[model samples]
Target: MPPAPDDRPGPSRNLAVDFCGVSRSYGRVRAVAGLDLRIAEGEVVALLGPNGAGKSTTLDMVLGLTDPDTGTARVLGTTPADAVRHGRVGAVLQTGELLPHVTVGELVELVAALHDRPLGVDDALRTAGIGDLRSRRTTALSGGQVQRVRFAVALVGDPVLLVLDEPTASLDVASRAALWETIRGQAQAGRTILFATHHLEEADTYADRIVLLARGQVVADGPVTELTGATRGRTLRATVPGADLDRLSALPGVRTAEARGEAVVLHCTDSDRALRALLSTGPSARDIEVTGADLTDAFLALTADPPR
Candidate 1:
C-alpha cells in the first residue's frame, strides 16, 4: 500500500521558513505588519524584539497556532499547519502547563506516539539532558527540570525545524549553558532553529543570523557581526571619580556619556581623540578600555522609536 500524501516527505528546499507580506492583527492592534523573512535550512536564527514587538505573534503564525490576515507563511516547503501535522516542526513555547500526574518519561512517550517518525523516548530524553529525570513526575520537577522535559517532548518528534520561545527562561546559569550546548549539537546536525530570547548575549553568541523586529516589522536583519558593526562607534569605559557626564559628552568625538558609579562610559566616533581629551582634562581617568559596539548597542539603535 502507498503512503498518504501527508505521510510522504516534503519536497527539498533550501529555505526552512519563508514568510512574505505577512500581517496579523488583534482588535485595533497590529501584531505583525507586512513582515517578510526567510530562514535557510540548517541555520540558527535569533528573533529579537521588545515586548509587544510581534515576536510571539510571528512565532505563533509559524507554528500555525494563528493565521495571518494576509500573505503566507511556509515551513519545509509546505503550509505551516501541514508541516506541523507531518511532524516536521517542533516547538518549545514559553507557556503551557505540563500534563499533571504524568511522569516525565510518560509525557515524552505520549507526545512521541503522536508523531509518525518520532525519535526514541530514551534518545529524546538523553538529547534533552533529562535522561535521569524520566522517573520523576512532571509536577515534582523544578522549573528548569520542567523546561528540560519540554525540550525532550519537542525533540521526541525529531522535527526538521525547531522553534523556541524563551527556552532558557527560568533556568539558572548552569542549566542555561547545558540547554544551549544541546541546542548547538542539534543545529550542527542540520536542523533549522529559530529561537526568540531576551538574553542578548545568548543571541550574540549562538545565532548564525539575527532578525530584529520593531513596530510589527523587521528593523534589522543580518549576521551578529554585521549588525553590531553597523552601529558605527566605539564605547569607552573608564574610572573617573566624580565624573561630569556633560563635560564628557561635550568632547569633540564623544556622542554620549553616561556615568556608572565611579566609571563613565563614553560613546565615541573617535576613541583615540576621546581618550586623549579625557586624560588631558582634570578628572584623571584610569583603567580605560575602548571597544566597538556590541549587539546590545545595535539593538538599541535599531529599535529606537521613530520621530513623530
Candidate 2:
C-alpha cells in the first residue's frame, strides 16, 4: 500500500512540482532523459521545446498519466497520482474528447463532482470566460469554445497546481488574451501554473521562468529577460530602399542581415555602431528601430542543432 499524503517523504513543502533524476522510455526511444526540475508554489512556469523534445512526456509524468522509468516525480508533497486524487492538481491537455449530448454547464458540473473539494461549477465557467455558453451542448462548441470547456473542467477542481498543455491551441487573439488574464489571476491567488506552448511571445509575456528542452533534455532554464539577455547583441530594423544585403552583412558588429520588403534587419553585436554605419553608407535608411533580443531569438539560439 502507498503511504498517506502527509507521510510521504518530500523534499520541501514549498515546491509544487518536483522531478529528481526522472527518466522515461518507450521501447528504444528515450522520452525523458534524467530530468531534474522543481517548481515552487505560486510560480508560473512555461515549458518550451521543439516537437519530440520530451515536453509531453514530462508533463505526462507530472499528471500521473505515466510513471517515470527511474527516480521520482512528486506533486504537492506527494505522488502525482495521490495529489491528483486529492484534487490538488489539475490539468488542461491538448486533446480530450468531451461527452456528447451534454451542455457546457453539465460537463463542468460532472467534473466538479469527481473532486473531493471543487470550486462551484458556475465559478469555473465564469473564470474560463464561458459562462454565456453554459447552456450550449458540447457537440455545438467551436474549437476555441471547446478549449474553454476543457479549461473550465480543470478550474472546477480548484487544484493547487495547474498544468496546461497548449492551453490556447485554438483560441482567437482576443480569447487568448482573456484566457491569459484568467491564468494571471490564478497565479496571483497562489496557485502554481506549469504550461507548455509553442508561442514564444506568450512565454515571454506571461511566464515567471522558462525551461527550454531539446533532445529529451533541458537546454536552457531561467527568467525570460535573463535567458534572452544571454543571447548576444541587439536587432536593428530600418527602411533602407534598394538596400545591399551583402554590404549590411559585412558591416562591423553586424552578425547577419536580411531583407524584408523595403526594410533591412540586422542582427548586431553593437547596434550603435551598426546604426551609424547604416545611415552613413546607406543614406536612404529611415524609421530605424533597435531592440534587444527577444524570447524567440533566445529560443532559436538555444535549441538550434549543432552544425556538422
lDDT (CA) per prediction: 0.89, 0.88
Task: Show where candidate 1 strays beyond 4 Å.
Answer: 1-13, 240-243, 279-284
Error of 2 at 164 (Å): 0.7
- Residue 5 in candidate 1 has what lDDT? 31
Count of backbone collisions in candidate 1: 0
Residue 101 CA displacement from its true place in model 2, Å:
3.1
Summarize candidate 1's per-residue lDDT along 1-308 as a digit string, tens digits. Answer: 11233432233537788999999999999999999998878778899988889998999989999999999898878899999999999999979999998899999999999999899999999999988998898999899988889888888999999999999997999999999999999998989899999899999878888889998999988778878888889999999987888988999789999988888899999999898899899557788999999889899999999888
Question: Which one is best on TM-score?
Answer: 1
* Residue 90 of model 1, lDDT score: 93
Angstrom error at residue 169, model 2: 0.6
Model 2, 306: alpha-carbon shift in Å?
2.0
Per-residue lDDT of model 2, residues 1-308, tens digit only: 11233533245548888899999999999989989888878778899999988988999899999999998998888999999999898899877799998999999999999998899988999988898999999999888888888888988999999999989976899989888998888888888899999999998888888899987788887787778888877999999888889989999889999998888899998998998898889888899999998888899999898797
TM-score of each: 0.91, 0.88
